[model samples]
Target chain A: MSERTGVIHDIGYRPYTGPREGRWGIVAGLLRHGALSTFGFGRSARSKVLPFGLLVVTLVPAIVFVGIISFVGMDSELLNYAGYQQVTAAFVSLFVAAQAPVLFTRDLRSGAISLYLARPLGPAAFALVRWASLVLAILAFVVTPLVVMFVGGLGAGAEVRDELPRFLVALAGALLLAVLLATVGATAASLTMRRGLAIGGTIVVLIFGLGATAILQEIGREQGVEDAAAWLGLISPFVLVDAVQHGLGDAASSFETPPDNPTTAALMLLIALAAAAAALLLLVRRYRTRGSR
Target chain B: MTVIQTRVLTKRYGGSKVAALDSLSIDVGEGVTGVVGANGAGKSTLIKILLGLLSPTSGDATVLGHDIRTEGEAIRTAVGYMPEHDCLPPDMRAIDFVVHMGRVSGLPPAAARERAADVLRHVGLAEERYRLMGGYSTGMKQRAKLAQALVHDPRLVMLDEPTNGLDPAAREDMLALVRRIGHDFGIPVLVTSHLLGELERISDHVVVLDAGHLLRSEATTAFTADTGHVLVEVLGEDAQSRMGQALAARGVAWQPRGQLLEIDPADAPPDALRDIVRDLAAELGLGLVRIQPQTGRLEDVFREEVPA
Candidate 1:
């Protein structure tokens, strides 16, 4: 009974990979999933209204304002063009970050996750595919605007020789921020099957992470530790983006380069990576636990 | 090779002393194997573990030669599962959902699409395949779920309560489908349901799970055998008394039971009981309704096995 079955060499095979291919594989997967989910977004009457209402109420106004300002011929130079980048970054973060948890959380809790798990897929594959999908969704909501801003900056007679580097820097910063947030959101969301809990929990963490600076300030003022509080403020990816943009300059504005603090920057990067990794681990643990149940 | 094997497979929830599957060890060969148990009999636990969806404590098992502990990914790929719950994504179309499942099972883009269509058609959902599953009846949803499981062409398919919420007519249809899947398609199927009589009707082999323990596993035919008791009915005045007197005069062993006479046809040829009853009825100018051999039902065996 214990004898081995005949080996099917072509079976259980995965292809070899290079770094660039792997990254785009993740990217393509995310885009496809995001597009598909867009069609299946509303399952219940209440959910149907909420997301559409949010898009109309929150996004429509911002999109219109961006359009109006761009057309008004206001000194493109005075717009703190970096502010536009930040706004776009925030939009991406908010949309992608909050959605990450809802993706798998709802499916699993509803027992829809079991449908996929019973197939040829495993935990790792499931997570990766989902993460890729979320990143693309974030791109649609967040990254597109930054690209528009960069193109606008170029059309306004901003020297490509000078402005191109800043645009690249801004794009890279946005990618890093979105990836960190999406990874965290997805990992955390995968911990439960309850969509409401997952979405609410992700929002709460983002709010805390965003507001950690102020909390630290109150603690510092009460305890007399201003410098440490200031440093703690840098823990936020939002603030980290601010620092990166502040250092990198805009299409129209350049500042004296500040000395790079390698240790502090490395520590912050490590923290982001760790949070993302922890979320993934928690999700894996959740899948294991639910499977057992 | 055995399609499934478990050694003392047990699972406990909420720290209760009554295990969901009390040291269940069973082997499943090719063809449809029906699992029968009451609502809380741990039949679901056994299916879940075999599909690598549940982790069994204090036991070792394998499905399709893949270890349940380490090679779950392989087992899951090779086995199809239809859960008892209403697990369908209501927003998606039936064909779309099944196609996605096929892709998840490692089929390439074109192949998954092709297989999805084939499966949906096979499950009798060809016309409604494009409709959102939310509007489907319980029977339609069951077929859609079954379509997804069959989409990947798995070696073994485990359907947990496939007729759970179906009407009697729908249930009979599902049972027929199960039989065809096993015999016609030649796929080994493991289906679970609390309806013992239903399983007896369709299943080639039946395994009874009682309170997380294996009560019995045997061929369905063997489980429901013809008892020697013969049911004799005759039409006349004082039918019971006259029947009894005739059997006594012939010195045949019998008992008066309700409006009929019961006889133990021991050591008699197959037609001997019929011959005696017919001749006696004719001589007494009595009309005989039936003289059939008494047979046990699957429900009777279930009751006898688990006394309440």
Candidate 2:
């Protein structure tokens, strides 16, 4: 065995005099690895189970709806581009919660992050790259089913003019949802080292934020506070993105009393953008103070 | 070239009065330089500060000509650090982890994989590189850690207690690898160990630290040079005392240590001392077993009284 596999070209510790891609390469490398790891690509078989299972589970609804709508020529608004994700947000949230720790918490918990920070990549860049990776991963989860739906709808005889525009709008909402969920998931995972806790915390924060915001919006409408109810949409990422879509008149509202007007929608989109920026800043600071120094 | 130069580097955690690394000022040159100290003697603190992973309280240092304060990332880019603690993720394969580390240190993807294989083989982790590191023995894990450090082909490497949990045979294997990294591979190595003997066998220079203070920093040859003492063992009744008396008559300083007499040839040439001892042994009717010169040890640095 040794003879067959012996190192014939053991050139012995040659110093790399070639060109380095520098810090950009480092960022790109980690970003790719983090994204793949979220869905357990490039990892052990056991790790692939949960992520791929959740992914298949999420895509099932899109496939079933598309199959029925295509063959029967029955059109339902529920199978619309943005409406599909709005309905299946639970599985999407579950997928992010289960996988965020794979990228964010494992290194911090195992002290493997010190190895990463030992490079030229600073803490701010490290956190940002990781956050970006999650955004891409979550985008994959939300985009796949929508793409399937759109293709299936077109093949099932939907008009390109009507469906294409709606598909683009849904794609935009998916991107927004991706960024918002990535921010929330990465922040929650970075808070603690415990894997189960990180997963639990992310799911709770997302679901509770939506539930609490809905209650507040309900209270605001009951008290006849229209502006406060629209603003309260900012508290939950699900409602905020949904409210934006509704206000733009692209997709139907997921919430009761969504105040479906262009003015409130514009305000909600601005609040979402501002909230995403603030969350990114907080995540970077969290990593910095942890001495990713 | 000087690999590391620190000036009054000090580190204190939180509101604690005692510093982890107190006023440490040292220069590490090329080849293997061993940093020796007990646990909490600031060996780890010094490595961390030099790597730019920790901020020193009130001093400055330069690694490979980059100032630690302003050019920490530049310094980190040029140096590879193997932390003393457990840094490996259990579920990852050794090859994957090392390749990832190479990429993190800025190597291109394809090169990272190639260099990862090379370094893992160099560290004697070639065959088992496919296994998850969690299943590895302490020896294999340490080798994996060392492989990751070398994967980037770093200009200088700081290994904090690489022999921490190795068995005797494994420790020998590790020291030999460290020696090759410094001597053959031509990468300047700063390896640390609490055991002086291990470092003495491999390091070219030795820096001793005790309780956050610099005890001594000098060449290994200086620490382990000939002590001007000749050991004499005689086989006869009262042969040890007789040899001692004869050596004293010849104006030699004699100290007995368990059936062997160490005679210092004060101002006498080694050959002259050997001739005198030969004649004295014959005249005293003692059978001289052997005469051997004694070399000092790095351990004696700790045995000596601390200087003010």
Top of the candidates by DockQ = 2
Please provide TM-scores computed only on chain A for all of the candidate models, following their numbering: 0.68, 0.90
How many residue pairs clash in all the candidates, one count each? 4, 0
Q: All candidates' lDDT scores?
A: 0.69, 0.86
The sequence of per-residue lDDT tens digits that candidate 1 reaches over residues A144-200 is 555565566556545677656665766666676666667767866776667677767
User: Highest TM-score: which candidate?
Assistant: 2
Q: Worst 10-residue stretch by lDDT in candidate 2 chain A?
A: A1-10
Tens-place lDDT per residue, model 2, A213-288, is 8888888889998676878888777887788887885577767657558898897788778878998899888877
Q: What's the C-alpha lDDT at position B298 in model 2?
A: 90
Model 1 is docked with a DockQ of: 0.24
Off by over 4 Å in 2: A1-10, A76-78, A215-227, A248-250, A259-276, A289-293, B233-253, B256-260, B267-290, B305-308
Top lDDT model: 2
* Model 1 regions lying over 4 Å from their true place: A1-31, A38-98, A187-198, A207-226, A234-237, A243-262, B12-17, B233-262, B279-287
